[model samples]
Every structure is written in structure tokens, then in C-alpha cells.
Target: MAYLYYGADARPAEIPDHVLAHVKVVAATKLRRGESFMLTWRHRGEGTGGRTSLWMQPSIPLRFVFDEPEPEALDSEYLRKLANEATSSRGIVLEWDDEAIVGHPGEAPPIDAMAA
Candidate 1:
């Protein structure tokens, strides 16, 4: 598991290491370009019926912590899909998948899924 610490909030958002890795790349890219977007995701299990969203911007302090000792290689296709979704008005929604942490845009799976 991984956690994303945003702002001064002590409770970090829990995420899978692979998922956090991909989100870190996409978020970094957008923040570097001075773009802001919303990152939405449904809560795991049945407790929270509503989804949560974070307003990501360049000014906010963000940290990514991974449980694994080494960082995973990024998938370009998956990153592209995330970036594309971030640019949309509705913003990006993080979804969990068994095959890959980050879901592909279309019918095709990520080209480098096995590498990650």
C-alpha cells in the first residue's frame, strides 16, 4: 500500500503502490505545467457511499509514500489516459483494477502492463 499526503492533513489517502506511482507522475506533470485538476476516487469497501475528490494544484504540498522498496516503472499509455482525463471538465477518477492499478482509456489494456 501507498499513501498520498496532501497539504497539512495527517490522514493520507491510502492507495496501492502501483496506482500511487502512476498518479504521482500524472500529478507532477500537470502541476509542473501550472495546471490544476480534481482527482476523484471511490472509497474502498462499503462504508463510504460517496466518493472523495481532491483539488490538485501546483501550490499545494504533496507527498507520495510507497510500501515497496523500489519505485515501479511508469506506463506511458496509462499516464496519457490519466493526463487526458485530468484535462477534461469532469477531471480524473481513479479506479482500481486487478490487471493494472491504473485503468486504460479504451478496450485495449496498457502496453507496458506486465513491466509495472
Candidate 2:
């Protein structure tokens, strides 16, 4: 699991390491270009039963903590899809998906292709 800490609030949003990794890339790209967006996610655990959205900007302090020692390979197609969602009216939504860690919406290349 990974945690994304923003602002002075002690409670950080917990996400999977792989998801957070992709989010980091997408967010950094947007922030670098001075774009702000809302990031929405369903709150898990006791006492937090609903969804929450945060306004992400370049000015806010953000921190990402990952439990994994090494970073995973990024899927460009997945990143593009995420970025598109973030810019849309619905905004970016983070969800828990075990399959997303390896293969996402786009087709995953064959093992032989990866070796090339």
C-alpha cells in the first residue's frame, strides 16, 4: 500500500503502490504544466464511508510513500487514459484494481515483444 499526503491533514489517502506510481506520473505532468484538477476516490475503512475529492495544484504540498522497493514499468496507454479522465468533467477517479497493476484497459504486449 502507498499513501498520498497532502496539506497539513494527518490522514493520508491510501492507495496501492502501482496505482500511486501511475498517479505520480500523471500528476507531475499536469502540475509541471501548471494545470490544476480534482482527484476523486472512494474512501475505505471505518468512519469513512463516502467518496472524497481533492483539488490538486502545483502550490499544495504533496507526498507519495510506496511500500515497494522498486518502481514498476509504466504503461503509456494507461497513463494517457488516466490523464484524459483527469481533464474531463468527471475528474480523475482512483480505484482499487488488482489487474491494473500489470495490465490495464489497453492490450498488453506479448512477452516476446517486451524482450525486443
Candidate 3:
């Protein structure tokens, strides 16, 4: 599992490593362009239901921690999908099933160093 630590409070949003990889790409791209938007994701935890959304800004603190030591190749189709959503009024939404974004562990090669 991967954890996205957001804000000064360090509120942790649990995301699968594969899905987080995609989110990281979108988040980094937006933040680099000085864009602020909302990131919403559905909860996958046992007792947790519904979803969560955050106002993502360049000024705020955000960290993406992955259990995997190395990065995985990114999915271009998924990346395009996320980028389009991010520019929309609805902003970006991360689905739990998007974990299929990357191949498992050694099954794939590493992505860009920036994504690491």
C-alpha cells in the first residue's frame, strides 16, 4: 500500500502503489504549472465507506510514500485520462480499481526518475 500524506496535519490517505503512481503524475504536473485543484478518491478500507477529497495547492505539503522500493512504468492512457479530468470543473478523481495501472513488482520496468 501507498500513503499520501497531505497538509500540515499529515492526514494519511491510503492508496494502492499502482494507483498512487498515476495520482502522483497528475499532482506533480498540476503543481508544477502552479495549478490548484481538488483530488478525490474512494475509500477501500474495511470499515471505511464513502470518499475523500482534498484541495491541492502548491503551498501545501504533500508526500507520496510507497511500500515498493522501486517505481513502475506509468500507464499513458491512464495518465491522459487523469490529466483531462484535472482540467475539468470536477477536478481529478482517483478510483481504487485503478491499481491495475501498473504491473506487479518485477513484472515491469522503472518509470522516469522524476516519478521516483
Candidate 4:
């Protein structure tokens, strides 16, 4: 699990590394344009399991820590969708789906399996 240390206080927001990578890109693009937005995601794992939202601003500090040594291979298709959603009233999302994640047991499925 990767942690997103947001703002000065630095509360770690636990997220899957791949998902965080996508969010990082979107946040950077929007922030560079001087746009402030909200990032919302439901809590995973054993906890209250509701959601958390952060106001992402250009000036605020954000640190993305990955457990994996290598950076994730980004999916442009997902990035485009996420970027589009970030511009909406709903803001950027950290939710996961088929493409947004690797696969069960942290291993990507074979192409043939995916096709099925």
C-alpha cells in the first residue's frame, strides 16, 4: 500500500500505488493550471470504511510514497478519464476498477484471461 501524505499535518492516505500514481498526475496537471479541486476516495481495509476528501491546492504540500521501488506504468486511458472527472463538480476520484488496478494477489492477469 502507498501512502499519500497530504498537506502540512501529513496524515497518510493509504492507497494502492497504481491508483495513487494516476491521481498524482491529475493533481499535478490541475495544480499547474492554478486550479484547486477536491480528491475523494472510499477507505479500504479494516476500518470505518467511509470516505475522505482533500482540497488539493497549488500551494499545499503532497508527498506520494510507494512501497514498490519502480514507478507504476500509467494507463493513458484511465488518466484521460480521471482528468475529465477532476474537472467536474465531483472532482478527482481514487476508486478502483478492472483497469485501475493490477489484479488479484498483486499480479496482472494474462492477456487471454483479460479477454475472457
lDDT of 3 by residue, 57-109 (tens): 99998999999998856766666677787888898887645445322222344
Model 1 Cα lDDT, one tens digit per residue, 45-109: 65766788999999999999999997776667777778888899888898885565645543334
Using lDDT as the measure, the top candidate is 1
When 1 and 4 are scored with lDDT, the better candidate is 1
In candidate 1, what residue range of length 10 has the lowest lDDT sum? 107-116
**Over all chains combined, what TM-score does candidate 4 have?**
0.79
- The C-alpha stretches of model 4 lying farther than 4 A from their native spots are 97-116
What is the C-alpha lDDT profile of model 4 across 1-116, one tens digit per residue?
A: 78999887757998888788778888877888899888998877666668998989999988899999987766666676677778889987677644556322343322211110
Please list all clashing residue pairs in model 2, or write none if there are none.
none
lDDT of 4 at 102: 32
TM-score of candidate 3 to 2 decimals = 0.81
Of the two candidates 1 and 3, the one with more favorable lDDT, higher being better, is 1
Off by over 4 Å in 2: 46-48, 97-103, 106-116
RMSD of each: 4.5, 5.0, 4.3, 6.8
**Which 10-residue span in candidate 4 carries the lowest summed lDDT?**
107-116
lDDT of 2 by residue, 1-116 (tens): 89999988889888888678778887887887899888988876668788889999999999999988877566666677678877888878887654454336654432211111
Q: After superposition, how far is residue 82 of candidate 4 from its true place, in Å?
A: 0.6
Which model is ahead, 3 or 4, in terms of TM-score?
A: 3
lDDT for model 1 comes to 0.79
